[model samples]
Target: MNAYGSYVEFDRARWAALRSRTPLRLSEEELQRIKGLNDKISLQEVEEIYIPLTRLINLKVRAAQYLDEVTSAFLGCEPVHKPFIIGVAGSVAVGKSTVARLLQTLLSRWEHHPTVDLVTTDGFLYPTRVLEEKGLMARKGFPESYDTKKLLDFLTRVRAGERQVEAPVYSHVTYDVLPDRSEIVDSPDILIVEGVNVLQVSKGQPVFVSDFFDFSVYIDAEEQEIRNWYIDRFLLLHRTAFRDPSSYFHRYAELTEREAVERATNIWETINLLNLNENILPTRGRADLVLSKGPDHQIHRVFLKDL
Candidate 1:
């Protein structure tokens, strides 16, 4: 191990060299469909970076299954089936959604053809009314802003082999949890859970969101880079989704470009930056893998948790 005791680091060239004979399973079109707003990842990057990363994850999944069987056999008990859970964490606009989606697509193409599911922890955030009542509207992405009990219960049921589990759905257009609807996740072979706070530990909570993860990843970027990405994304939303009459940010559509940018900068500075510095950044070392990105938003290094 290097001086970073927990992880052995690899630069892009070395990390990309870890790619085995695993063939690329995704096309550029499919990748474009899954790519997040303002996050640019070329097909070449997928081949060099993500494909190799997915291969590593596949190895871990197989190892985990073997351990499960061996442990069950040693205990002379029947093995209970459980999905391999992956936690993907990062700051807002750090391209975590893209990573989660890409992994889901690639992992599903493995020889075993394991069923994969993707869920974002945004769905677990408390409703706007609830946040308003608690006077936490401005502190929205913090740990306390989530309905921790509900999220914990959902994961508990998933790990318990419960089928047809339903989770609340949050809409970006509405910017709130949909009261009348939820998204159902049947028992899957793999579940990718992504969010800004997936790796966070709550002080009084008995179970952390990461406790259920078989493997976890933290997407890393400098604070200023993330801040710029967030503002850029905000501007993009203003021109597109924010222009919709039903959008929560529709009012922003009318602002001058300068005003919109100013507002986005303010939100990033006051809200997202605070959450990242105080909560998200502190949890980076806890991840099983860390993908550090350059200012261009391309992953430049990998840090694998050393056994």
Candidate 2:
């Protein structure tokens, strides 16, 4: 295998060849629903790439279960059914959300793990008022913008196999944490956590967000490509979602197309790019798997850590 730190590298062709007898379970309509705004993922990509990836994850799940059982038996305790948690981390506009959702759907379809739940770290971000008070209004996606203690506490509870744990809900339209709304995490067989900062280290905290992850994936792509996609998505939102009076970005929607694009580019260059370089990209090597993508937003290579 090709080398990448302690990982094995596989080109798209080689990675595709790993698929074996995994059924093509999703339809075009379902894919359309799963895809993020302006993101492209064909069914063939799922068959050739994600099918094998999910198969591998299932294997890991079974292995984890066996280890848990053995450990419990050795300690003279009953087996505790702690759910397997998978963390998906990436730069903004890299399609980590889509990957996380797809994996949740695919893994849930398997008999071995039928109760997959997906949660995004967006829900952990501080409220707009809090951010404004903290003077982090423009750094919304950065690690400091999140309520790290609450997020870590939630994950700790999940790791202890706690049930009925509720997560705060964040709205993209309003760009703030929803008031009095939460997503309950029942006893799921598997949980997928997706966000830009999932893999990042929380300074001065002993328990990191990634500490609860049984497996993790980091999506990789060229900075320029990601920037272009981010701008495109921003423009699309400006024309549609941002046009709503209730949208946080309604002011941007009023700008001319050229002005809107310029604003998006400036945000990317100043905030997103800086975060990607300093924080997100630095965590790539720590992931269990890295899905490297081309300018087309399609995964072209995979790097799996040596197991």
Candidate 3:
């Protein structure tokens, strides 16, 4: 229906020309890190989109903190504290992960905040064993494949002003959950929660993973472009990470190039694309902002609902 499969049509050049008043600063080191993911990281996009976004979120967080302080003072509390949670959601291979990581670094560097942390919803996915037990391997990214209750519990604890909470970590190399290990979610000035279905709303459930978010973002792109990106990233991984003996997907590396690409395409068409259409796409409207990307993978425009 639109360039990015959204109902809205946009012109990249015109949108890029819309001057943003937010300050954006990135050192060479920061640029290099972003380039590692894709060499096409433009300072203009960062300035026009992410910078304004960070400033808006910063203001919201500050307002939230102030209101919290007033409420605490009214109740005669000793201290007021809680991390601001920002949720990033999108289809697979939409580069939302890179955005989350970048924002975590950039926002933390702001003089107003001392710490920022990035946490992913991947860790909340049910383990391979559990998935197999429930016969949900084919539906891995589907809502039913996740431990929604545990995810809700973890978020509730995080929202309750808990000082520390542990989230399980998933190892792509091992293709399994690291049962004995966990990442400490120490309190921070802000927490970036990034994942495909983090913004999903299950109609039947009274609880949802997105309830914990203070702000949410949806990274949007056309389905064909997303599928293409997924295939390209898979091919890249096949040449690099999948070549490692420790890589769980190494089995595919032994195949001929044609075979490997075929398998990757099948997986993308069947699993990832299906999940995106059925589960993730429905949540775009729920985000506080939607970052619409062009076919070339650069952002075309941003849509923020009226406050």
Candidate 4:
């Protein structure tokens, strides 16, 4: 299907109406935090971009449950409920983390809903040492650098409702996958997997990462705008968090402001932008929904599969 179209301009009012009739998950505290960090992405964006999304996902979950009940009765057995998996994918600076975090809070607070778990594919990244040993350090965010087999196994186990499963952790400050630590997943009613390549196609002939997803979303934006956002975020982090002596990026932080800006721009142009174009952007069409963002870093278009 020819899903891509020229970007149409619209005002916030249109967005609000289109995204109306949905519930939001933000508590006053969470709303304040989001508001403080993201002036561009506000409560309105959540109402428009994420609220309708949650409603769609909730229906998907309830439908899956209904199917289980039907199948169980057909087989003369009790219903077997499983967690609903939602995979959110996008470029590095696309705010997918916020999406996952928000959904976790909202989905859990839904009347009588079970716990919602959030995980990132970063946790499944090969540890720095492993990547270095395998000659994949330069290809860090690329698919080849990941332990795809292990990630698949983790999802397979989670889908089957494993009693206790541990997911390796990644430290943003260190900018490395942790070698010795992981987060434990007790079963939850819902699981949200967010990352640049979370929805990537599997190389195996018979199955892939997407095979495990009940629903998937692609956070979309123009290449130039995304690149700019990445650079902006890098600069912001460098001036703030990166200044901490204990920060893993402290060495970069110690550089002259000009030097740091040069390095950040170069990395954005060479690594992240390249990865998004080569590996991630092509998969946007694969998502059940595509949230196309404009220069302002707010959603401008929503392309959903016609049911």
Candidate 5:
């Protein structure tokens, strides 16, 4: 492995070699279904990158299980089962969601962990009304826009193996949290938590969100690449989702192509970029593993923390 600061860096080819003949478990259709709007992932990429990643995670899970059993036996107590939580964090358009979803799907297919669940921090974002009241509408994706206490409590209960724990649901179409709805998370064998702020450290909080993660990943790319992806995604949405009358961004559907580009660029610069620099990017070093992407959205390199 190539050494890179505190991490062991692996280029795409090297990282792919770690698959160790693991069979490709995902189909192209499935990959297409899970990829983000502007993200590019192929079955080849899955076989090379994600398959090996999941294999590594599987080994970790097995070790954790064995440790739990050994500790229980040593203490003359019954073994307690707890979900292995994985946190995936990144910037607005860095494709962390795609990675998280892929992990949930692949990890569940493994015989040892048949139950894998996925959750996004988007659900924990404050509602539009609350943000408006707090004067944080423009800062929606920033750390302050989240209900950290609620999120922490949710993770605490999940970690304790609480049954039927509920998390708030978020609607992308409305760009707000649904007050009347929630996601019930039954204790699964593995839980993948994905979001922009999952790795963030709260200054005054006694416990941070990352404390609940057994493993964490940061999806990385140059700032300019992410900015382009965000703009491209906005343009795609302008032609599609934003055209829906019920969409919160429907107003953008009326704009010309140039106007849409300008507006999207402005939002990216003024809000998402600031959030990335001030809150998100700083947490990159905190991740257990980091997947760095190329401009084409393919993960070109991986930086994994040494065990």
Candidate 6:
């Protein structure tokens, strides 16, 4: 292992060796369904990168449970059911959602944690109407655009082991929070919180979002690679989702290929790139583990915080 600051860095081969014969529990079809658009993830990628990562996470979860149990017995109180929380953070098109889903699936299959739930910070974003009113429509996905209090309260309740906790839902079709809809999260063995802002530490807030995370992962890649991925995703959406009449980006479907590419590039430069540089990238060092990807969209290096 190569020591760098507080982390121990491992190349792909070294990291893959840590799998320790952990059986691959995922099928190809399932992997396809879990991957995000324009994100390249294969069964081989799962074996080499994610399987070992899941093994590490499984050990962490078991240890946490044991510690909690021992502490409760020492305190002469019944052990409370507390789900292990994992936070997945990355830039807009860096495949944060895909990683989150993969972890949720793999972690659940371990049998010790069969009920894993996945939640995205997208659900906590303010409605488009609210954003427009606050003049934050252009700043959507920025920290100020979220309902942090509501998100904190939701996380607080979940961590408190409250039953049937509800979180607000957002719709990409309308590009807004669904006023009448929410997701009910019952007590589970693990909850994977995924989003661009999962690791953000807001100033003046006594409790930050990352405070609720038991484990956090940061997906890392070179800025130019991420920009290209974002553009590719946008173009794919323009040819597919943007063509749907109800999609928020339906107007983009009418643009010529050149115009679409120009629009996507402009948005990436003005909004996504700015957010990544100013806010998201700065938080990478705070993560417990960093998965650095190569231009091929596969994790090439793993930087894990030393205990």
Task: Give TM per candidate.
Answer: 0.96, 0.97, 0.91, 0.91, 0.98, 0.98
Give the per-residue lDDT of model 4 (tens digit) for 239-266. Answer: 8889888777888877777887798888
Candidate 3 per-residue C-alpha lDDT over 1-307 given as tens digits, one digit per residue, 9 for 90 to 100: 4433434433555444443554566875776676434325577667766676787788888888888888889999865468889999999888987889778866886776668888788888899999999999999978898888988888887777687799889897887788998888777888888889998887789877788899999998889988888877887888888889999898887777788789889999899989998999988888887888888888877776545
Q: Which tens-of-lDDT digit does each residue in 1-307 have in candidate 6? A: 4433589999999999999989999999999999998888999989999999999999999999999999999999999989999999999999998999999999999977899999899999988888999999989999999999999999999998889999888888879889999898998989999999888887778999999999999999999999999989999998899999999999889999899999999999999999999889889989999999999999999999988
lDDT minimum window of 10 residues, candidate 6: 1-10
Query: In the order shown, what is each candidate's alpha-carbon RMSD?
Result: 1.5, 1.3, 2.7, 2.7, 1.4, 1.3
* Model 4 CA deviation exceeding 4 Å by range: 1-25, 34-39, 202-205
Q: Residue by residue across 55-153, what tens digits does model 1's lDDT show? A: 988988888878889999999999887889999999999999999999999999986537999999999999999999999999999999999889999
What tens-digit string does per-residue lDDT give for candidate 5 at 1-307?
4533589899999999999988888888888999989788988899888999999999999998899899999999988778999999999988988899999999999988989999999999988999999999989999999999899999999998888999898999999898899888898999999999899997778899999999999999999999999999999999999999999999899999999999999999999999999999999989999999998899999999987
- Judge candidate 4 against the unseen true structure and give its global Cα lDDT, from 0 to 1: 0.78
- Measured on C-alpha atoms, candidate 3 has an lDDT of 0.80
All models: lDDT? 0.91, 0.92, 0.80, 0.78, 0.92, 0.92
Model 5: lDDT equals 0.92
Please give the TM-score that candidate 6 achieves against the real structure: 0.98
TM-score winner, 2 or 4? 2
Q: State how far residue 83 of model 6 sits from its true place (Å).
A: 0.7
Model 2 alpha-carbon drift over 4 Å, by segment: 1-4
Q: How many Å off is the CA of 250 in candidate 3?
A: 0.5
